[model samples]
Target: MTTTPALETVGITKSYGSHSVLRGVDLAVPAGSVVALLGSNGAGKTTLVRILSTLLRADGGTASVNGHDVATQPGAVRESISLTGQFAAVDEVLTGRENLVLVAQLRHLEDPGGTADGLLARFGLSDAGSRRVATYSGGMRRRLDIAMSLIGDPPVLFLDEPTTGLDPQSRIEVWRTVRELAGRGTTVLLTTQYLDEAEQLADRIAILHEGRILTDGTLAELKQLLPPSRVEYVEKQPTLEDVFLALVGHDTTAT
Candidate 1:
């Protein structure tokens, strides 16, 4: 028999005062796969993550994480999922190791120290484990936050723009880590404005616009939503640079 989806949201809607953020949004994430939520700013990506992580309630509709209703079974949902927000949630005053230990302890895990050590080593933060998080670089702090999120070994992870402000190398490192997590049977729901990131990591891609899913499918499928790719042959063909400038009015080669 097929296993149940790791996450599901049906007709989820949320409003703040007079403004509606999510308008009957629906999503499903299978275990051991990456589901990328792509959208422009204000498309409700963060709001959806908050609802799924049980940090906020949906104004209407229902959501479930690993078969537990988010509204009625929030504790069970929390037990099965972890969330890493756009900002690194590390405590700047605490050491990297201290942060992991604190998370493990809060999860009520036995041998929090051993767990912290293992995570530090896994995330390549072992050498800096004793240093205060304030001294770490952006990438290191992001890694530490992700490691802390894994203290409970959750079955599902919610990454909300986890690499928002990193350099290219650091972003690649985080991507590798995300792929590794999904490979280990952890379902991942990733939200990002980066189209390339979504294409690289998502098994399925969903684009949100105006608080609704405009389209959802595989990379090839999403590309199909755009005009068909054109092939041209020339002695000295226009490069992607020239094409980008012609279409989008940005000169990629200009300093």
Candidate 2:
């Protein structure tokens, strides 16, 4: 018998009025693997995520998380999954510690304070936990937002553009966190525009274009689809990111 994937979708489609957002897309993510969904801004990445996470309904097709149908078994799907949206959703007026404590209490986890403290420390925000989130740097707030999602230890996670405003160092910190989570058998589906981030974290990568998947495969498998490189006569040049940053003047002095 074939095992159900940790996350699976067959011919998933969505539309906003007359504007089609997803056009019969299909994907399957295996247990304990990180799959990156990549697309340009309006390629239906967020729309697909919303449907799978049960925040929105698919206009067509079927999706399941941990063997539960997202359309008919939303509660079961929710019990097994967590989503960190593009924006930081923490309460600006609350302290970092308070935000975590609130989620812990709502989840009815015992010893909320200890749990909050542990998470704060894990995210390297222990010293700043008492400060109101209004005073946090963008990276700090982003870290706290992710920590809040980990409170219940959900087996599946959907991170939608999770590191958008973070600094380079904080981005690496979150990458390590994701690697550890997958190592512990948690499945992760990440939607991102950052090519290198996907290269670093994803065991498999899927690209969405015009509401359908362009390709979905392991990095090596995907690379094989490209035209083989011609023999190089000169040393390889610097990457476009290096040239862009140098030309645009990346501010090391600012966070």
Candidate 3:
């Protein structure tokens, strides 16, 4: 039996006046799987994400999350998903625990304090819970950010460049958390410039370029589409953008 996608889009289109940001994009993300969306700086990845998350409306075409139409049933879509953007949305003045509490209150979860404490411990921030977010390290703040997102236990999650500026170790921590989330059946749609992050965490990957998907498949399948690397090294090295160029071509790689 085929499962209905946790997230989906068809002929999705968007534009800013004369500039078209999206053009007839089609996508389907399976339930309980992690899918990574790869793209360059202005490839409209965020635009597509925002549309699915209800932060932005598509100019045309249809999109849905958890089977609810993004345009017409936006409230139902929002109720089933959570978004974690490039920057942490936490407040610096609030303690780590307080930050989670704020989100819990906003979400109307019962026992906001207890929910905060549970999330703190789950994210390994239990000891730092009382410390002001102003003093937390970047990784700590990110962990808290994700933990706060999880308080609602929404079935679908959108992580937009979540590891962008994190140190290597912290990036790994976030990657691990993402894996755990998927393992527990959360459907994750992650967009990132870090190719390795996608390779490491995503069960499938889609390349978004020129306002469209050039090709999408498992890592091994995508590699097969590209010609064998002519330049070999003592240590195999394929930069994320190298993979990007190989699969999607150079049209979208403009600096």
Candidate 3 — which pairs collide? none
Q: Which stretches of candidate 2 lie over 4 Å from their true place?
A: 1-4, 231-255
Listed in order, each prediction's TM-score against the native is 0.88, 0.88, 0.89
Worst 10 residues of 1 by lDDT: 246-255
Please tell me which model should have the higher lDDT, number 1 or number 3.
Answer: 3
- Please rank every candidate by lDDT, starting with the best: 3, 2, 1
Candidate 2 lDDT over residue span 97-171, tens digit each: 999999999999989999999998787789898999999877777778888998888988999998987766557
Residues forming the 10-long window of minimal summed lDDT in candidate 2:
246-255
RMSD of 3: 7.7
**Residue-wise C-alpha lDDT for candidate 1, range 1-255, written one tens digit per residue:** 024678888899999999989999988787788999999899999999999989999999999998899999999999998999999999999999999999899989999999999998888888899999999877788888899999889998999999898855567668878887877888999999998899899999998888888887889887888898789985998877457546754321111
Clash count in backbone of candidate 3: 0
- Compared with the true structure, model 1 gives a TM-score of 0.88
In Å, residue 47's CA in model 2 sits off its true spot by 0.5
Task: Predict model 1's lDDT versus the native.
Answer: 0.87
Model 2 residue 120 CA deviation (Å) reads 1.7
Candidate 3 minimal-lDDT segment of 10 residues:
246-255
